[model samples]
Target: MLAWAGCLGYAAYYSGLDAVAGISAGAVAGNGVHGAVGWLFSTGDELGRAGVYALTLAALSAGSVLLRRHGVRELPGAVVVLGACWLFLDSHIFWPRGVFTMLAFAVGFGLLTVAASRWSGRLTNP
Candidate 1:
């Protein structure tokens, strides 16, 4: 739980402001359908994008805390999905931080899997 919170909190605080700009810049650099749309529509341009990122960060943080408190097993899967989304979205944007964040989330997923396997009788031990 602390790990999840820490990961999300760090991402939210560090990347929150830059995420939108990074995404836009990355999109322009990546040059794809999403990038084109972002460029054309100016979705999340500057402060707007930052706001969205902040809100998303808050949501993720809250979700992580809630999942941990409730002992929900789906938290790991959620983290993986969120990480994948960040990876894909940021890949389009060309942000290095996005790549780093993706890596963090991937590692978290791996850790979660290992932990689950350790606890569950269904897992075969080598």
Candidate 2:
């Protein structure tokens, strides 16, 4: 999921759409055909593509942390997915442009995921 979003955003950015691809990036984080349409329309023109690289960075970084927290441990799907994104997906945007963004997103989402994991609400505690 995160790899798909990252690759899609990277490709969109390279196509000269600037950051407007973020719309599709956020949209693709979920499921369904709406994301496909959003990716197509957003990348096709100049509208709704702002902050795309940042979106990719956030999704990938946060998703990696979350994957680590989960049980994808046998093969380390996070590393595998990230590596595949860089190798096959051509994630130059992440190396040269979005490294800092990825770091920031990683820290932010890591904390959030931890806090959420520790949370014990009325319903959850029961």
Candidate 3:
């Protein structure tokens, strides 16, 4: 959950619109570079933007580490909140390869959930 939140947060902050565009392009034209470049070049104020991005990444990494140690169920609300923020923050932006990123995240999360569920069941059932 924390990892997902971090990824989502990073996606939102870096290239939401470009992500969407990238996804669309990949779906229609089979390419993401155009959309990705769009966002990459859009970063006009590098120093300030980098600072903000760095802070956000730090927070996300810290949150993920803390949450992992504590357990996902112990802070379900926080997980949901972070996930929502990530989704909303990225929804407005488009990027090249954005669709692929979303798909990757979804698949990764799905696999993680399934694996965790199986592990939990094994621990309880055994």
Candidate 4:
């Protein structure tokens, strides 16, 4: 379940990047009823859709590798999901600039995940 939450977190973060870049990106890469397929290959645009793909793939692969390598267990799925949701929603409006608080929340969310494991009786004690 934590793995899924991790995936969600990665996806949401990328979505936020997409919002910042103002590009369609992979958010709608393969939609059946859309011409957005070409959006990923757009070269005229500075951001270029491939950047999104790269960021997304990097996030997913890195997140999975780091989680598995460190034997990180006991991640609270709710915190992840909620945090991702908040990020996705907040990313929709980047003009006013609120990413600072979001960054703090992300840090807290990471710490919370570890703390959740400890408090849930899985870890001996932090």
TM-score of each prediction: 0.34, 0.27, 0.31, 0.31
Top lDDT hit: 1
Clashing pairs in 1: 26-93, 26-94, 27-93
* Runs of candidate 2 exceeding 4 Å displacement: 1-92, 121-126
**Per-residue lDDT tens digits of candidate 2, residues 18-102?**
3444555546555565647666554634431333553446456656656555434312334443443343232334665456545
By summed lDDT, the worst window of 10 consecutive residues in model 1 runs over: 40-49
Winner on lDDT between 2 and 3 is: 2
lDDT of 1: 0.53
Over 70-98, each residue of candidate 3 has an lDDT whose tens digit, in order, gives 46642443443345334433332235444
- Cα TM-score of candidate 3: 0.31
Model 3 gets an lDDT of 0.46
Residue 27 of model 3, lDDT score: 56
Model 2 RMSD in angstroms: 13.9
Off by over 4 Å in 3: 1-96, 122-126
Q: Provide the global lDDT of candidate 4 against the true structure.
A: 0.46
Candidate 1 regions with alpha-carbon error over 4 angstroms: 1-41, 44-95, 122-126
Give the Cα-based TM-score of candidate 4 against the true structure.
Answer: 0.31
RMSD of 4: 10.9
- Could you arrange the candidates by lDDT from highest to lowest? 1, 2, 4, 3
Worst 10-residue lDDT window, candidate 2: 84-93
